[model samples]
Target: MKLLIGNKCYSSWSLRAWLLMRAAGIAFTEELVPLDTPDFKETVFAAAPGSGGTVPVLVDGGIAVWETLAIVEYLHERFPESGIWPRDPAARAHARAAANEMHAGFTALRGACPMNLGKRFGPRDRGPGVARDVERLAALWGQARERFGAGGPFLYGAFCAADAMFAPVVTRLDTYGIAVDPLSRDYMQAVLAHPAFREWLTAALAEPAIVAQDEVDEPALVDLRKS
Candidate 1:
């Protein structure tokens, strides 16, 4: 299987699919197409003909699955023993719901603070929209951890598709210096410290390609990419 993704530094969606597969030990080769390049659309379209020219397209032989959620489902179905989702039926349902909510919601925070792994910003009041989004995120995470995360630090005990879905959100919270409750903070720490996340972050920092839109206007407190 070959997963076609975008730049590690700026592609949050790509990180979702890549992190899930990598953490699950699902062996698959990856191809990175730097975003905003001249032939990005063409390259993605060629690789995933009907994917709406998006990143994180997983191609397994003749089957090409696009969209991060679809990719998660595909992998879960393909490798049931991989434990991509939770083993319990209730936990599995909640995990899927949480992942889908992440997929569709949280545009306010996403717009205010795009996921940039190389820089850290001093937190400030972005806006009411951002504040609301952050509040919701914390509550959502807290709910998951309280209900199903006793087995491990992740949302659903062990790292699963739901954690993969929110992994980039974890980056956004840390990068923008957004504060969360202790539970959420601990969950975020676990995500950031994960081996899969560390591998992705290291590669992201080394990436020279910069997406201008994703780069915020605020001055960065720490620019680790320069260091």
Candidate 2:
């Protein structure tokens, strides 16, 4: 298996997919491509199936999976014993719904927070859209923790697809220094303490490919430390 990712410092989708693969104990050769550069499109086009030039492309044997969710599904199918999704049908369905919601929704939070792992900033200057997204995220985390997190600290307990889907969101929250209640904070801690997440952060901290545009968009007093 070959995993093509973007710069670990800024590519949230790549982080999610890489964390999922690591959690599943799937060993693969990793290729990191710096995003938004002049050669980025050419590199991705050469490696990917089509001309989308997207990051987080997974090459499994002869097959290429592009989208993050699709790549995760492919991994789950290839390694059933890894338990990427739940065994129970109802739990699995709920997990899929949550993951899909994360994939398509939360535009406001994603746009405002933009995952820069361990970056810190004041929350006072956020927009209404960002505030609303934070509220919704906290509510969702509380509900999931109360319902399915009985077995462990993760959303679906034992770190399933749902948790993997929200791992980037955890990074966003931490990066922006968003404060939540006890439940959400605990969940965030679980995400931060995960070994795969730590590995990603370690690599991200070492990366020197600084996108000036991304850095300028963030708060001036922010710190990009591995939380």
Candidate 3:
């Protein structure tokens, strides 16, 4: 299998599927396409004909799956024993609901703070929309951890697809210095400390591309890519 991704520093959606597969120990090769490039659409089309020219396209054999959620579902179906979702019925249902919510909601925070692994900033009041989004996210994470996160630090105890879906949100919060409750903070730390996430971060720091739209107007506390 070949997973096509975008610049690790900026591609939050790409990070979701890539981290899910990598952290799950699913064997696959990766291809990185720098975002905002002239050839990006053409490249994606050639690799995944009907994929709507998106990153995180997973190509296995002759089949191509696009959209982060679609790719995740495909993996869950293909490798049921991989624990892509929780084994417990209730836990799995909760995980799916949270993951789908992440897929469709949280645009306010997402717009206010895009994920930029190469830089960090001091937190400030972004807006009421961002505040509401963060509040909702914290409440959701707390509920999941309280009920299902008994076996590990992740949302569903052990790292599962739900965690993968929120991995980039973890980065977004950390990068922008958004404060969270102790529980959510601990969960974010676990995600950052994951081996696969570390590998991805290292590569991200090494990437030379600077995508303008993904970058924020605020001054960075430090440029990790240079360090």
Query: Which one is best on lDDT?
Result: 3
* Model 2 vs. true fold: TM: 0.94
C-alpha-based local distance difference test score of model 3 = 0.95
What TM-score, computed on C-alpha atoms, does each candidate reach? 0.98, 0.94, 0.99
lDDT of 2 at 52: 82
Which of candidates 1 and 2 is the stronger one according to lDDT? 1
Stretches of candidate 3 exceeding 4 Å from the true structure = none
User: Over the stretch 1-227, how does candidate 2's per-residue lDDT look in tens digits?
Assistant: 99999888889889889999898898998999888899987887777748488988998777888889998899888999897998777777878988998999889888877777646677655788888888988887777777777888898788987888999888878777777788888899999999998999998988867776556364545565533
Write one digit per residue (lDDT tens) for candidate 3, span 123-177: 8999999889889999999999999999999999999999999999999999999
Candidate 3: the clashing residue pairs are none
Per-residue lDDT of 89 in model 2:
79
Write the residue-wise lDDT of candidate 1 on 101-219 in tens digits: 99999999898889999999997988999889889999889888988999999998999999999999999999999989898899999999999999999999999888998899989
Show the lowest summed lDDT stretch of 10 residues, model 2: 218-227
Query: After superposing candidate 1, which stretches have Cα over 4 Å from the reference?
Result: none
lDDT for every model?
0.93, 0.83, 0.95
**lDDT score for candidate 1 against the true structure:** 0.93
Candidate with more favorable, higher lDDT: 1 or 3: 3
Clashing pairs in 2: none
